[model samples]
Target: MNENVSFYRDTWAEINLDAIEYNVKSMVEHLGGEGTVIAVVKANAYGHGDYEVACAALEAGADMLAVAFVDEAISLREKGMKVPILVLGASRPEDVQVSIDYDITLTAISLEWVKKAEQFAKEGVLQFHIKLDTGMGRLGITEKEELDELIQFAADSSSLSVRGIFTHFAAADELESDYTDCQFAAFKKLLGGISNKEWLIHCANSAAGLRFKDRIFNTVRLGIAMYGLSPSKEMNKELPYSLQEALSLHTKIVHVKKLPKGGKVSYGATYTAQEDEWIGTLPVGYADGWLRQLKESEVIAGGKRVQIIGRICMDQCMIRLPEKMPEGTKVTLIGRQAEEYIPIDEIADRLETINYEIPCILSARVPRMFLRNKSIMEVRNPIIQSHSASKG
Candidate 1:
């Protein structure tokens, strides 16, 4: 089903557009008529083909799209996406005009940034959201006096339009909701008399949006959950709705060899065969975002779990096979195989990280093959595209 089947390498990531659409629709319906969903497509939709995911999200009722920087928003624009995009990070003063030119929304982190951006505003109105650092203490206005000043300045500037004001929840995904409650209280106190109707006021990421639905907010930035990942493992039990995982990492065994007892495999000579064993070399490694730390992890082969032995290399890794599997055997790093499964959460648990980091770290070296209805809809191979373009 892959149109570029002959071009890309054996290792690739399969993205399910249907699953993405389902997740988005579930989030919207779960909101229960309170707020709109802003599909957070930053980090290339958390490294799952941004444009494709964005299109699927919009089709599923997402009200807007949000990215981390200006260039990311521009990329969506270049792909003919006209949805309102809010850049979540601070925009450089000099590049404010570029955001304005693209009709993108910028985040006003501080009164100083607002003042600086006002000076750069040349012609049309620039829309932005005021970020409040209620408790996160990462970005946004932290002081009440500063918030007042910024509100006044934005009101006075004819070239600037304040479309929304938002804060981030620090512990919304934890079992304890006390901290989230305090953060919401602080956000309300900071708002004072600023009517929510006047501007879009949001404070919920995926976790808070689901756990604290009673909180009054007009917009919810759907990030991890939109891609069918729980914000935290502990909170999985409390989820109100089911989420379908949309990503799967797969590769074919390119080489297979039988090693006798006392044989060592890969770098460091770390893995020594206890007895005669069949070893398969996978065409995926740290370079492809399969971190070396996953050397002890497991992959599915022959519909069974196989131990990954030896240190993962820059471009390859080895998996101990159940038997002498034939070459081109399908290996699943993060997906289902017959009766066995390797979830992203399992990989995250092994790596001592969160589920969000798992997919986001998958390098572009592994091309993305998007599927719908169990058939390849499109293939994005940067290596092949670059080579073809150069030749042209």
Candidate 2:
């Protein structure tokens, strides 16, 4: 069976659409089939390939797609994603109109930004969410006077329409309402005075959509939980439904060699052979989202788990495969079968980080394959706009 594997091949990131569709449908149960939901596909769908995952989410009934910037929106538009896309993050002041020109809605917080958008408008109205900050202390306006001023400005400006008013929860996924309730109360207080405008008053993200009963919102922008990842560790025990992971990563052994006892391996000689044993080099490493900190973890190979040894290099990592395993053995960096699974959660746990970083860190050099109905559908080439690679 090892003959089928090519040692020279590059590692791959695999996406399962069936599971993605299942996750979206399960998450959208509360949004109802009619209510709008904006799926955040900014980081190439968290490195799952935006176009591929966007289709799955839309197929599962997502009302719109959301991203962080104009460049990302253009990528989706270039790739034929015709669904309405809203830039949830702030649009560059210089490119505000560029976003409007491409039919991409922006999240404008000030009258100046709204006016900047007027330069590109010739006909149909340009839309954007008025972001309000309650607790996350991020890019949002918390001052009621300023928010009211913006609202008043929008009322007079026919070119701009207040599509939505939203705020981020400080601790919704923590399952604690102390701060969440405060944020909600503040959002409600702000919304109470605003009248007849048909703006989508939304604050609930994935956690609120799943746990909270009174969502009190027209639309929910789901990000992490849509990919079947719990927003935080606290929600793990409280989740009433099982969530299926949508991403799976796999690679094959590139080299298998037996070393003498006390032989040191890899760069820096950190891992010394305790006994005469077999070692297999995997072609997946930090470059493939397998961070160097995960050197303490293990990789599944030959139906058994193998510990990663020594320092992880840019394009390769070494795992202590069984002495009996033949060369070219299939290595599973992340999978879901055979009494084992290396889903993103596991990697996150090993690294003591969030699930978002796992997929986001996978280098663009790794080709992502999209699978639908348990069959190979298509391959999305390396992302060209990898400018956000260093972030998070």
Highest lDDT scorer? 1
Instruction: Tell me, by TM-score, which candidate is best.
Output: 1
Clashes of 1: 0
Tens-place lDDT digits, model 2, residues 1-392:
22332223656767888888888888678655645677889998888889889999999988899998889999899888888888888776667556666788788766666666666565667788888888888878878888888888877877777788888887888765578888898888877777755777778888887777576477778788877788888898988577888888888777778888999887899989999988888887776677889886977887778899999998888887677576667777877647777777888889888888888888777777778887778775545335345453
The regions of model 2 sitting more than 4 angstroms off are 1-10, 119-124, 383-392
For each candidate, what TM-score against the reference? 0.97, 0.92
lDDT score of model 1?
0.91
State, as a TM-score between 0 and 1, how close model 1 is to the true structure: 0.97
Please list the residue runs of candidate 1 whose C-alpha ends up more than 4 Å from where it truly belongs after superposition. 1-3, 196-198, 389-392
For model 1, give the 10-residue run with minimal summed lDDT: 1-10
Give the whole-model CA lDDT for all candidates, comma-separated.
0.91, 0.79
Candidate 2 TM-score to native: 0.92
Model 1 lDDT per residue over 1-392, tens place: 35546445789899999999999999889987778899999999999999999999999999999999999999999989998999999889778888899999999999999999998989888899999998898999887899889888988989999999999999999986689889898998999978758688899999988888887478899999998999998788999999999999999999999999999999989999999999999999999899999998899999999999999999999999888999989999999999998899999999999999999999987889899998888888878778888999
Compared with the true structure, the alpha-carbon lDDT of candidate 2 equals 0.79
